[model samples]
Target: MVLYQIYPRSFADSDGDGAGDLQGVIDRVGYLELLGVDGVWLSPIMRSPGADHGYDVSDPRDVDPLFGDVDTLRHLVEALHAARMVLIMDLVPNHTSVEHPWFDAALAAGPGSPERERYFFRDGLGEDGSQPPNNWPSVFGGPAWTRVTEPDGTPGQWYLHLFAPEQPDLDWSHPDVGDDLDETLRFWLDLGVDGFRIDVAHGLAKPDDLADLPDDVEIAQLVVDQRDARWDRPGVHDVHRRIRAVVDEYPGAATFGEVWVGPVDRFARYLRPDELHFAFHFALTGAPFEAGAVREAIDSTLEASRIAGSAPTWALSNHDVVREVTRYGNGTLGTARARAMLLVELALPGITFLYEGSELGLPSDYSIPHDRLTDPTWERSGHAEMGRDHCRVPIPWEGSRPPYGFSTSDHTWLPMPASWGCLTVEAQIEDPESTLSLYRAAIETRRAWPGPRSASVEWYGAPSGCLAFRRDDGVVCALNTSDRSVPLPRGEVLLSSGPLPSGPLASESPTGGVLPPDTAVWLRPH
Candidate 1:
């Protein structure tokens, strides 16, 4: 099934609040239905302080006012189902906002309090009240722990925060934590959501005995201390199995996990019959955009999925990474190269995540002024390269409107790129040669050419240059990786990034024609 990812704040603003909301998303369900995708994966919309956008959730069951109320969210879900599309909510279980009731209560309870036990609170006293429990850095930057005063008017112990200081890591070791999570899942499942996209699913558990980083590993120490406590611990399987049981109670519901590390084989662990149904395989998204690298990633993912007895999910871009167009689309390579990458992703086995604006071939806007930056990574890392705000700019819907239909007012949470006026939905929808039109055709072709889910891929040329691959459907995908094209063998061209050649060829000489760079073609035996 085809999947679309919607970064809520940047999608569409129906109320024109300058920030996208649930109602705005509901208004666009028709657009998604028309695009022919089976489902949409929404980024987190739960109650949060917006510290890390919506990932740092304070309340799991309630909708944030910034997005909308619970009623608005429920209505959006209903609208999605009515349009014959599934809705998947982002589930951030690894951590919670420090403002969350649970965390606040834990902090107030102080040391020796049962509520504090629910979190990772280490007593700072050494043999004579002199040292910390362990040295660990936060994922954002600096020390993972922060001191606070307890309600008892005493110097409180420090608490662990893997991400931002405001986002306290949850104590999965506590049984009550699982119960709370299950209740939250049941709350959403009862609302008829198709499934959940679990965030940092591999990082649900940590070693019970918190350990310091090895003294010899400088990088590991600089970053967060390698904590075996959280992430891929054997105990996490229990939590997944339990969640799976809850999901099974509601047939047709599914679970996808965000697993960041481990081999493909290890990734499959999350997809155990009793756990998640699929986990995102990000190997290709990070690999160099070359045919050989692409082939190896695809083949390895397939093999790993096969061994795990589960299917894999592929994603090229998301809220966290740079836009695929800018990442892989060298402006000089022309549209052909862009289309070739699309073909490879579409033709590969398993579910494909189409990030919002990806269909319109939107490029990342890196012109954010220093003063307007919103991403915490930029401030915390003191490095502009670490932030992802460029890729998270508002989508361009209106051709001439300032902010490109994202906002009518002078200000928006993030400014729409200046190029959005030229690269917008309205302009592209009317042009037959537009990227949006090509994407539509590609989606339709993929659905029409249903083949074995376990199809094997065979690479046929140099990794960086022109390449060919045979799909299970018997169609050969020939792609010219360079700006110039090499001659094609005998075949009828089914589709091409550019116009079709003049003559029907039996066996043409190896004529080096101009490919306009980065173009792709689908061919079938004449």
Candidate 2:
């Protein structure tokens, strides 16, 4: 399935609120259908305080007003289903907003109260309880433990927040936590959501001891090491098993996880038939435009999925990472490379995810000013890391100006780059050589490709700095990753990521038609 990820805030605004809403998504179902996506995987739109975006869920069962109300969500689900597309909601089960009612009760209740027990509430270490219980740090930086005041106004116990302070991690060990999430799953399932993309899926369980991190451990801003006490604990599988049972009640429903485990074997565990349908295989997301790295990522991901007897996922860009257009080289070269990779990714055997704006070949706006940054990582890293705001900028839909038809208001939640005028959907659709046109043609060609449905890839021997693979259906996909052009494989050209070299393509010759660098092509074997 081609899964299109819609980061709501930057997608399309319907009410002139500078934020994309459920109605906005409903209005764009036609656009998605035209893009050839079979389903839409929406980022979190649940009730939140906007701290850490929607990841800090205050109410799992209700839609956030920023997006729309419950009725609007129902309409959206129906609209997508009517269009023969599936809607996969983002589920944030690892934590809740500090403003949530349960958290409020947890604060009001004494240290040993059941409400307090629902979370990881612990008395501080050292005399007068002035120190954190452990040395683990938050994913967003700083200490993960936040000390709260008691009813009498004195210093009280500390709570664990794996991310921002506004997001307090839930104690999954508590049976009530599992029941609460189960109820949340059923609530949305009843509303017609086809599935869920579980947020922070590897972070549900914590080490039982809550021990201090090893002193030698390396810490990257907003990245938790897989071996860290706060992530990928063995007990997390129990939570997945329970969720799978709930999802099984509704046949045809699936669940994908946001797991970042290190080893492919461990990553595959999350996709075990009973755990999750699949997890985002980000191995290829930020890879440079090189053949070896790309090949390793593909082979590793396929091997893992093969071991699990499940289909893998491939995506080059997403909301949380730098856009591929910016990462590959960040200009004309970057755009070309990104388009080439799209052909390679889509031709692979598995579910493929396309981040919003990717089809338009949008680049991240690295110039977004400091004061305008909203991602917690910006502040948590002491300005050393600029965060993902650049990648989350509002997309250009039409026109040649700032708002660019994304919203009625001149201002948006995140500023739109003026340079995107030429990349607007209206602009690209009119140009046959535009990125949008290329994507449309590629997806259309993919839909019509007569190929055996096999989850395997056969590598073809090729010159250095180039890679070739043949599918079971006799379709050969070739990618030239070098700076110079190379000979094309023997086959009938189905689609080319970019324009072919001048002259006609010759069949049955290893040194046939030239394949330009940063170009990919699909050919039916002669």
TM-score against truth, every candidate: 0.92, 0.97
Residue 196 C-alpha lDDT in model 1: 93
Error of 1 at 207 (Å): 0.7
Residue-by-residue lDDT tens digits, candidate 1, 1-526: 8899999998988776788888888887887877789889999999999999998999999999988898998898889888888999999988899889988888777788888877788766575433556766665666667776778787668777767778878888788888998899999999888899998888777677777755553322111323334356787788789889888988899999887754666677777788888888787777666666666777777876887788667877889887777787545342445556777777776788899988887887458887777887777676634478888888888757667877665577887766567678888887888888887877887888766546466666533566677776677776666544456644666666665453333134232233334667776656
Prediction 2 TM-score vs. true:
0.97
lDDT of 1 at 371: 77
In model 1, the runs with Cα more than 4 Å from the true position are 125-132, 152-154, 215-230, 329-336, 383-386, 461-464, 498-516
Question: What do the candidate models score in CA lDDT, each in turn?
Answer: 0.76, 0.87
The stretch of ten residues in a row with the least summed lDDT in candidate 2 is: 218-227
Model 2 C-alpha lDDT per residue in residues 130-182, reported as the tens digit of each score: 99999988878788999999998999999999889999999899989999989
Model 2: runs farther than 4 Å from truth? Answer: 220-226, 503-511
- Model 1: weakest 10-residue lDDT segment is 217-226
